[model samples]
Target: MKLPLQALDPDLFARAQALLDDEWLAHDADLAPVLPTVLARGVGQDWHKAGTFRHHLIGVARSLALWQQPRAVRLLGLLHSVYGNAFVDLVKFDMATERGRLQALVGQGEEELVYLFCTASRREFTQKVLAGQIEPDGSLPLHTNQGEPITLAPDVVAAFLVVSMADTIEQWFSWQDDIYSRFPDTDTSRQQKVHWMASLWPGPMRPSGRMLHQINRLGLALQHPKLKGRLPMPPVFEACTAPFSASDDAAAASLYWSVIQQDQPLADLDVATGVLEQAVRLNPWVGEPQMVLAQLYLSAGRREDAARAAESALQAFCSWGNAWDKRVQWDAWIAWTRILLQGATTDGPGAWPERLDKLNNVALRAGA
Candidate 1:
């Protein structure tokens, strides 16, 4: 089967395939090693948005990886806001003093991109893209901190937009909206919350507002008459812009978040299962609802249903981004899905030990 980014970035797509073939997250060790042990202390502790800074960072990097972005863009996503920006005020690295330290870690080129990403006005960049304001030479006009004007080269614009898209998708969630909203407690209704967040952004960027804005920008770029050969259209661009309705994501997120918040969520298995079933149908691209449904099915001894759900969950994680749950990496969720698959696939209690050995082998060779 032709994967999402197979044509645009064959090597990265192959890396993705290597990961799925081995059933482990280790295949992308090339990207993971850039964030060394020295920098981990700060990023691992700071709180950002709805989760820890480390989780958000890795999630953005993984999102870029899923989109089959080039290594530099992926690295930029990983360390995008370490120096802080307009949206978030948590700075893990000092701009003036720590630039050299970060450059030593991720190299000068990537560090520069990260600095640009952190210092530039992402809101302005987003607004320009939405307004179709790209210059004929593909230059993007932006302003850095304190409104210093800067125009990005065409090549730099492409890289910046990709990292920006990944960053927006990785962190923009209803939970994120609630975190930054004044009336978070007051807006209890699902539709109300979605509408409230949607109003904060531009156009029909509703249900999944931030991501939809990115999609809109990409769509305009793809169709732009002047950008025909100048702007490169990524392979995952098609998949990301696939036919997913606004209400689908809205309802799915509402249901998924509500259920997971309960005191003893799985205690009422029937209700939980039904809710997840609807959620999975509404937004099949997300894996958590399907993953949880598989768990519920397994507990109910519905082996066939459990196995099917687990497989679907794996497919979803492999195909697209999943920022529904920020606490865990996409690979960790894939491992959980495989474990559930093993439980649902095994014949009896004796088969458990044999499957366990296979799982270990897969994990060990995932990077190979």
Candidate 2:
């Protein structure tokens, strides 16, 4: 069995609904004006991961906004891949024909940033920058698909890196392990399937070592003493780059959480709970362990503990730069955690199947 279920508390539901409404309203406001243009370009109709391409685009923008990036950067993020890049060939807007139209929508400066992001060799740029290959003036050497060289000013390099970090965080998940399949890109031996279908299909699951490695590397670069004033370091970068070593425990916790998610024996719950508890202690800043611990507590009839764990999860998520699982956005995670809060505080028992159904439905709808 998974977590024990409980009826949602009515009062808690009202509070959650109000909070979510406000959050969504703010998010919508952040996307205004440019959002319409994005929709008109058929972004909403294009497929991406477990959701529409528009959803991914919006997610990237939201990440940038959460990091307190400027409006132009957020706009650049929203339209980052519209012209198609080396990674995906899904072109929502043709650069040759629609550049002027998009420039008019988000302004020339923001559109140019998007254009650069789509046309430049992002992976190569990232590698070079991380390797400290920047020019003396802090300019970045970039190349186009045709191997044409381009030079990015220091400010532009900073902005490009910020957007690149958000883009990775928005879409990377364990299910897409194939992206890191190159010889040295990832150590596949260190990765494990977080779900039954994780290796076979695309879905929400824990990120792999390859993903974390990329994130940490980017975080380190951004956190470097040199870039301090150049850009605002994303909160996730700070958390992940903190002077703490919880890698071993965190990896163990991930495996335990994965097993807990499966049709495992009941005897394994206690062991998994202990592992997760220790993992969170080592690094309370990480939300996944606390979220899983809340589930375990709820299953064991520890209502108060479950409530606290859920609250902690919410707090951690607030500062987290990306969704723990890429199948849904961070807002959806907030909604699910609120439900957990209600269930933990409520008194009546409920069917776990119903609760799981509700979550699944929300994820599907949100993805749509």
Per-residue lDDT tens digits for candidate 2, residues 149-214, read 998877778787788877776776666655455312445464455534445656446554355455
Q: Which 10-residue span in candidate 2 carries the lowest summed lDDT?
A: 359-368
Query: Candidate 1 residues 1-368, lDDT tens each?
Result: 21121111335435545544422334466565766642565887877554578767776766667666677777887778888898888887899999998888878988898898889887777667767788887888889877999997776777766666666656655554543332212343556555665444332211242243344355445444544444334434354345555566567777776667663355568888878788777666666788888877887878888878877776656655544465565567877777777777775441223343554543322321
Best by lDDT: 2
Off by over 4 Å in 2: 1-30, 135-137, 182-200, 203-206, 237-257, 263-265, 278-285, 301-305, 327-329, 342-368
lDDT of all the models against the reference?
A: 0.63, 0.65
TM-score, predicted candidate 1 vs. hidden true structure: 0.66
**Residue 67 of candidate 2: its Cα lDDT?**
67
The window of 10 residues in a row where model 1 has the poorest summed lDDT is 1-10
- For the record, the alpha-carbon RMSD of candidate 1 to the native fold, in angstroms, is 8.1
Cα error of candidate 1 at position 350, Å: 7.8
